[model samples]
Target chain A: MFEAVYQYRDQLLHGLGMTLAVAIASFVIGFLIAAVLAPLAVYGGPFLRRAIMGYVALIRGLPELLVIFLIFYGGTVFMTKIAGRYIEVNALTAGIASLSIVAAAYLTEILRGALLSVAHGQWEGALSLGFRRPRAFLMIILPQMMLRALPGLGNQWLVVLKESALVSVVGLEELMRKSVVGAGATHQPLAFYLTAAALYIMVTGVSTLLLKAYEARLIPHMR
Target chain B: MSLDLFLPAFLAVKNGFLLTVAITIASFALGQILALPLALGLTSTRQAIRVPVSTYTFLIRGSPLLVQLFIIYYGLGQIELVRNSFLWPVLRSPVYCAILAIGLNSAAYAAELLAGGIRQLPTGQWEAGRALGLHRTALLLKIILPQAYRSVLPAIGNELVLVMKGSTLASAVTVLEMTGAARVFVARSYAPFETFLIAGTIYLVMGAVFGRIFRFIEIKVAIPGR
Candidate 1:
């Protein structure tokens, strides 16, 4: 078992790299979307808030795989029809897009929750200090919100990282797909998958540790 | 604009909805059964018991359920030992593999949630129980566990929603569940948008309904002052 995994070390590493890249890309894109949607969902006027709420609800309820298919297969078809030509949307792009969209929904919720946890008095206090609304939010509220949101953001990152495995169905050669391919080629499915599971466990384990440490560091300051 | 297509597409895939429900219920039931022992193990003081349970939860929670499904469906099936074992009959079916995979995944999550709830019981409660001369098992069963379940009901509902959504991954392993039905329809009709739109709507409805039920439970079961 060890020999089989050791022999495929390079392939596994490459797959790990791809998994991290896809996860990180999704996180960045999702954070950007969260930056827009979270505020709208939390404090926007009625119309904008309702629109964001609907999007979040739909995304939260649907399966990630179905969303991926809709974006990859459905998006491809729609684009090709519009362009009156074949438009290539690769598996990686599809994976990142779908994961980011889902992440954005969850992230919006997390951020909104964190923002709400910040007392209304804090905002009022900032306003009484003659700070404009945007400045008060950025200068007074954002830092505390980041501290509160960090753990949730970390969990969301882990979620995207794990969900990246689903991208394998689209034929992206990420960790899960590579493990499957290796298992098939080597005829040692257990060895390859155990290795894959172990790798995931390791990444997630280290992430939990790092997040805990980060939270610990921030705790004293919060007091 | 393509609203007319949704009815036939939905009709064709409605059975898949039942399959999805079956998978979710079976998996959730199995998870609930297994969670009790695992949750106990999690709250144990002995490193021997705690470490393994913690690691198991960590592992399952960390990885994608898709990989876990593939591992069981494809990975375990490859082993000569497994293929020849008494369990081979059960392992041969993709449905069993999907259930086992998702069930175990859900068990890990459920165990963690229950453990968290158990830990949150006021230490004073346990001390009060001891003062009353209650046996350990009686104390746990009558006092701690019941309150733990109440506290964790909302969290467990969240887990159920997850299991339901996760069951859609069974589509990958040749199970024609709701998502799988949509995949088949798209293959035949070449209508990716309409097929998935209907499927996505069904999932959204299931989630919305469950979300409301969980909220109602949380409010109904709230402790008077707390």
Candidate 2:
């Protein structure tokens, strides 16, 4: 029953590594994009703000799987057109791109809320203290916003982690895809899938614990 | 780029759109029914009941719904007992399996939402219910649940959209929901952009319609003064 897991241990470990890499890479990239977009959405001109909002709305409205498929297939066509030859978008690139796109939309909303929660007085005080506007925003306001955004950011991280599993639909050979392959080859679907589930649970469980500890350390007074 | 495929793609996805809607509604209804009891268990005073229920939600919430769907659809069939059991017929169908998997996953999140709502209710409501001589079940059904659900109505609406998005995964197991339909059409026509865009539009419309309906309900059910 468990022999298949041992036999495919290397593949499973590689899959797990890929899953983490995709999740973390997408999340960091998404957060950086959101950091820029959220502020623009909140403070930019009406046209700029509306454009950002539209992008967010579009992503939010569509299913993640559809987004992944569109990026995977459409991107190949797009790049092919650009290069004047067929250019295939690999599953890994598509997975990370699509996930990052989806994550950016959600993170923008979270960060926007956090940004709004920071009072105007903070900005005014920073300027009065002789700090430039951009410097004040980067130094004083951004840190407070991030602290307030930590809880929502933590939840989004978990969501991104789970969503990475969907990338397997395009044959990315992530944890889910690897498990499918193992199950098929070993003819032991239950054992392989159960192991996959256990591995997911372990990562998520550890993440939840770490997030909680970090949140506690940063926001001790809230408790 | 393929303007010609747009109308044909729409026609192709019509049945798939209906199927997507059906699965979303059915699974969401099933989740709500399961949620009430799970929510009660979560809020139970007894550790025995609460611990098990919490664990169930924890495990379900921790993993991906795709894995859960595969477990039910593919993993269970591997069991000799499950294969021979009366439940095999229902479990074997990908549609039913998708519904069961998504419903179970939705129930975990809904239960947590309800539990959060329940915990947020002031103890004054419970005291008032007790003063009126309402029993435990009666007090819960009448006084507590109504208000708790009301407070969490927005979150509940959001969950509906999430479940609808989740229904797209049913395609993976060969259930031709909208996404699956789009995939098939694109494969045949080699028009991925047009087909997927049409499918995506349908999803966007469905989400907007549901959002409006929930917003209307929220306004209608508002407690007059506070």
Candidate 3:
């Protein structure tokens, strides 16, 4: 009943906090990774471009669940061995790292597409000014690249927010995991799960509105 | 951990292969069947139908499939009414729940892809089909669908890889599929890396094979690179 919801209020809040923490941290890290790898994939030498493409192919193709398991269970033991002590892989850290890695591959492609959209002649213009490729990328190319990829990046954020649920496999006390616990404890699987679904709906709803709002403000500038 | 001793890894793959294929095939067929009509509905101009179709697509597309799977399977099982109803026979089965989850998820995404493909068709083709005495069903079946499939095969192929991976969610509901069985193997073998590595390798190979098949299909209709 309502009492169950009230009883688990603190736990649910704690779980929500963890989910958002991982979602924000992983997405920010993924964006940073994407911003760095994107232009490399687009403009690097054949070998480097191949390396980036190979990375995207491998990570994007592999199951996120497998990656999570690799990092959470497998990496923990490897880390412990290296550290000469017990290095536990808690739910939060694993959730953040695996999600960042997984999201990075997708974001790289999104960003590369955006960067490639910048007219090749722009680079030529930079070259005419005797600006090195790095200087051109730093001074002129990046600011416009951000504008092109912003909407796609927004969609990716929605994905990150939702896919965070999967990290619950590592026993992360996020909404999905908390709902499982709530179901087991309350013996009301239907209610708790439906509630979890609603919570997801809520998060997605507000965030979509926020994205649309931000896009509205920025669209005029792009136009 | 001897690199030389790889029997268990081999055995796990042998054991879990069928379940993996079963989940993939079942979801793929179901997704396509559901997607075609859902796509038509989405692209249709009818306001009544459009609203609900968009809502379904929005909700499913916006949220994570993992949460949807958990909500449908583990969440519904706790319902007294569902337990009491005749649907319980179907609902109690984890396979059915997994199918429902994968079906719904793929339907939403594939519908959008299908819609995009449909839109890509030159409107003149439809008029041409109409001029040739083709009605709605005839034009759609013979003219639009084939062309639409070309534009969408790549996206659908990507979705197929997603479905194959999403099938792992079935493990959460106590289904002893590849990932599920891998968990047990890891616990018993206490070689976490080896077990997971084996599981990951299986998925990668499956994805690689699927990618090649899709490429072959894509070549049939793909525009040559500029």
Candidate 4:
């Protein structure tokens, strides 16, 4: 039962690496986009705020799997039209793009909440200290908002890690897809899947612990 | 680009739409039933009960639902005992397996939600019920549960949407839900965008309808003050 896992250990490890790569890449890119969008949504004019809200609502309404399918298939068609020739959208690109889009929407909300939680007095204090608006935001306000957003960002990271599994549907050789192939070849679906689940549990468990420790360090008084 | 496929795609996914709705409703109902006992166990004073309940939720919540679904739909079939057992009749069906997997997953989250609600209630409420000559079960059922559930109503509404989104994974197991129907239609007509757009719209509408229903229930049940 377990022998098949050991025999295919390298494949599983490689798959794990791919899964982490996709998760981290999409998360970092999504966070950058949300960092911009959150402040814009909070401070920008009514039109800008409404447009950002609409994007977030539209993305949140659809299933993540559906989003993956839309990007994977629609992207191929889009690229084909642009170039006047068929160009397949690879699974890795499609997976990252869709997950980033989904993550950006959720993270935007989280960051928006975090930004609002920071007091208006802080902004006024920065202005009174003879700092320009952008300089004040970058030097003082952003750091405090990020600290407040850490817990939510950590939660979103876990969500992204789990969601990365959906990338396997489009043929990305991630942990889920690797388990599928291993189960097929070894004819031991239970063992392969259990191994995958255990790996996922291990990663999430470590992440939770690390986040807790980091949060404790940053906000000891709150704890 | 394929404007012609929109109406036809909508027609094709009509059965799929119903299947998605059925799976979401059934799985959520199943999850609610399972969550009640698990939530009780989570809030229990006994180490024996609380430890195991928390561990179960931790494990279930840690792993992805797709992996869990595969473990049930494909993995269970690998075992000779499960294959030979009377339960195999239900286990053999992909639709049942999807529901069971998703329901179980939803139960873990719901249990945590319920447990949090229970924890939030003032201890005075429990003491008050006990002082009124209520037994443990009566105190829980009559006093603790109603308020706990009411406090968590909005979270429960959110869970409904999450479960509805999760039902899309049933397509991976060949359950022919909305996503599956769109996949089939896309394969046949080579119009992925139009078909998926229609299917996605159906999902959005269903989510909005469920949200409205839950919002109405929340309003109807809301306590007058505090």
Candidate 5:
């Protein structure tokens, strides 16, 4: 297994690059989407809030693979229909979009939970200090939420990384898809998979430790 | 738009829908049973047990379920020993492999949740149990596990919903679950959009229904005060 992994080192490295790229790209996009959606879900009017909540529920409920599949195939068809011409949706594009949607749903919830964890009195305190609502939220509430949201966001990052593997089915040359190709070529399915699993473990386990240490450092200030 | 395919697609995928439900229920049940010991191991004082169990959970959690399924479904069968072993019959079928992979993955997650619940148990409760002349075994059985279960009920509910969604990946291994059925239809009709839209709706309904049930159970089983 180790020999096979070594022999396929270049291929595997390329796959790893793709996986990290997709994960990082989707995470940034998802974070922005969550930022907009979380505030709406938390503070919007009743009808708007319900609409956002329902969107979250639908995304959360469906499988990520299905979402990717639907987006890849359905998006192509929909776009083709709109233009009355073929519009090929690339595998990488579909994967990132679907993963972003899923990540956004979970991130929204995480942010909302963190926001709620900030004491109601803190918001009132800022308002009483002569700052307008937007300025108060930006200066006071946002910092505390970030502190509280760190641990959950760390876990969500791991989730997005792992979920990126599903994009392999869409023919995205991410780590898992590359591993599949390598396994088929080498007849070392076990080695390729175990190596993939190990890579995932290393990425997630190490990042989690770093995130936790960071969270620990921030804890005193939040307190 | 293939709106005409809607009823046929719905009817065609009925078996797949049932299979999905079966896999989810079976995996969740087995995972819950395995989770107890795993949770206990996680909360154990000994590093020998705790380290190994924690590593297992971490590895399982870090990796995607699709990879795990591929490992078990395709990778395991490639092993000469596995092919020669008594477990070959079970390992040969894609459905059985899906159950094992999904079950173990979920058990790892539930174990973490359960262990966290156990750890959060008040130290005063343990002291009270010890002060009441309860043995360690009796204390854990009567006092600890019950409270931990209550606290972890909602989390376990989340785990079930996760299992339901995760089970869709079994289609990659030819399990013919909802997603699998839709893929088959797409292959034949070349209508990915309509077929998947139907399958997605079914999954959405399943999730909503299960979510409501979990919420109901959580409210009904809420502790009197805490």
Candidate 6:
């Protein structure tokens, strides 16, 4: 098992790179999607808002594992049909896409919750101050909502990082998959897995400390 | 594939939901039980128990449940000593192992949530309970638990949804739950999206329904819904 880790040092590094890339990409895209959907949720009539809410609920409720699988398998199938040729959906990309959708759904709620928490009077107050519709959002609302959302977003980011493990089944060579590979090659499942756990701990531990610091600095200012 | 395959997928998601519910309720129950003591330990008027429980909560809260599940289900199961120690039957089955894992996981989180609510309660309530001649259990059950549970229902509800989502980790260990079923479907037809899309729909619907039920229950207990 140690040999597996040794033999695949470069590969493991690559896996970490891919994992980080996937996490960042999915996070950005997911936030964008959620941003688009959030306004729809808030401003649209009951029917439109309900439609968006339904989408959000389903995405958030389902497991990332299932989402990854669906995207990998379904993306390929659907893409092939539309284009009249097969298109391979790489495990890493599929995992990112699927997770992004799931995260976006969760984030829509996060944003909505934050949005609601911002008193309605602020909007009218801004408008009275001659802040136009768009200017009001940028100056008056967005900052506060973002402050409220920071902690929740931090938690969700951690979740996304860990959920990337599910991408292994789709054949992504990330940390979890590398651990599996190492375990298989060396027949030291326990050792490799434990090492994998340590690596995860290092990543998460560092991030947790950072997020806590960020929260401490931000929470007081926001209030 | 044939229609028969769909049955298992549906059955699997249903069973998965059942397992999901079972895990959430059991985990919350156990978590609250364990965490309260631990929280008390944290604020203890003692140090020995306080330190270890704090450490336990920190470690558990810090790690991902996927790793924890793998450790409990696969790592522990692989050990001959564990098998021989008389927990074999339960440890061997993925379901039991999942419950143990999830319960522990929730315990770590719920203890903190409960503790937060407990801390937020008016100190006068405790004093009032003390004046009423209530001992530990009666004070907790009568005054503390109800208020904490009420105050934290929304937060706790969020945790419940999280636990339900977390149960998908069980699919990795060969449990044929909802995600597991969708996985099987994808493995068979290589149509991950359709299978997962359908599966996701089921879960979303389940979550919505669960949310409504919890809301109803919350209303019944608190402001009493009309």
Candidate 2 lDDT over B1-226, as tens digits, reads: 7777789988988869889998999999989999999999999999999999999999999999999999999999988899899999999999999999999999999999999999999999999999999999999999999999999999999899999999999999999999999998888887888889999999999999999999999999999898
DockQ, per model, reads 0.79, 0.89, 0.70, 0.86, 0.78, 0.52
Best by lDDT: 2
lDDT of 1 at A29: 98
**Once model 1 is optimally superposed onto the true structure by TM-score, how far is the C-alpha of residue A67 displaced, in angstroms?**
0.5
Q: lDDT of model 1 at residue A136?
A: 98
Clash total of candidate 6: 3
> Which parts of model 2 are misplaced by more than 4 Å?
none
Q: Provide the TM-score of the second chain in candidate 5.
A: 0.94
Query: What are the per-residue Cα lDDT tens digits for candidate 2 across A91-193?
Result: 9999999999999999999999999999999999999999999999999999899899998999999999999999999999899999999999999888888
Colliding residue pairs in candidate 5: none
Query: Over 4 Å off in model 4, which ranges?
Result: none
lDDT of candidate 5 over B1-226, digit per residue (tens): 7788887777767769999999999999989999999999999999999999998998899888988999998899899999999999999999899999999999999999999999999899999999999999999999999899988988888888899988899888888999988888877876777888888898888887887898898888777787
Ranking 1 against 2 by TM-score, winner: 2
TM-score of chain B of 4: 0.98
TM-score of 6: 0.87
Per-residue accuracy of model 6 over A1-223 as CA lDDT, tens digit each: 3675777677776777777778788888999998888877997799989999888766767767767777788788878888999888788778888889988998889988888889899999999999999999989999988888887888888778777777876788887787777666766666666666667667778988998887887758565
Least accurate stretch of 10 residues (summed lDDT) in model 4 chain B? B1-10
**How much DockQ does model 4 earn?**
0.86
* TM-score (chain A only) of candidate 2: 0.96
Comparison by DockQ, 2 against 5, better one: 2
Score candidate 4 by TM-score against the native: 0.98
Q: Indicate whether candidate 3 or candidate 6 has the larger DockQ.
A: 3
Return the candidate ranking by TM-score, descending: 2, 4, 5, 1, 3, 6
What is the lDDT for A156 in model 5?
A: 92
lDDT of 3 by residue, A1-223 (tens): 5578668878887888888888999999999998889878987899999999999988987778878877888777888989999888787888899999989999999999989889889889999999998899888788778888888998899889988999988898898798788878887766776677777878889988998887787748663
lDDT of 1 by residue, B1-226 (tens): 2777788788878979999989988999999999999999999989999999998898899888887888899888887899999999888888888889999999999999999999999999899999999999999998899899998998899898999989988988999999988988887877889989888888888887888888988888778898
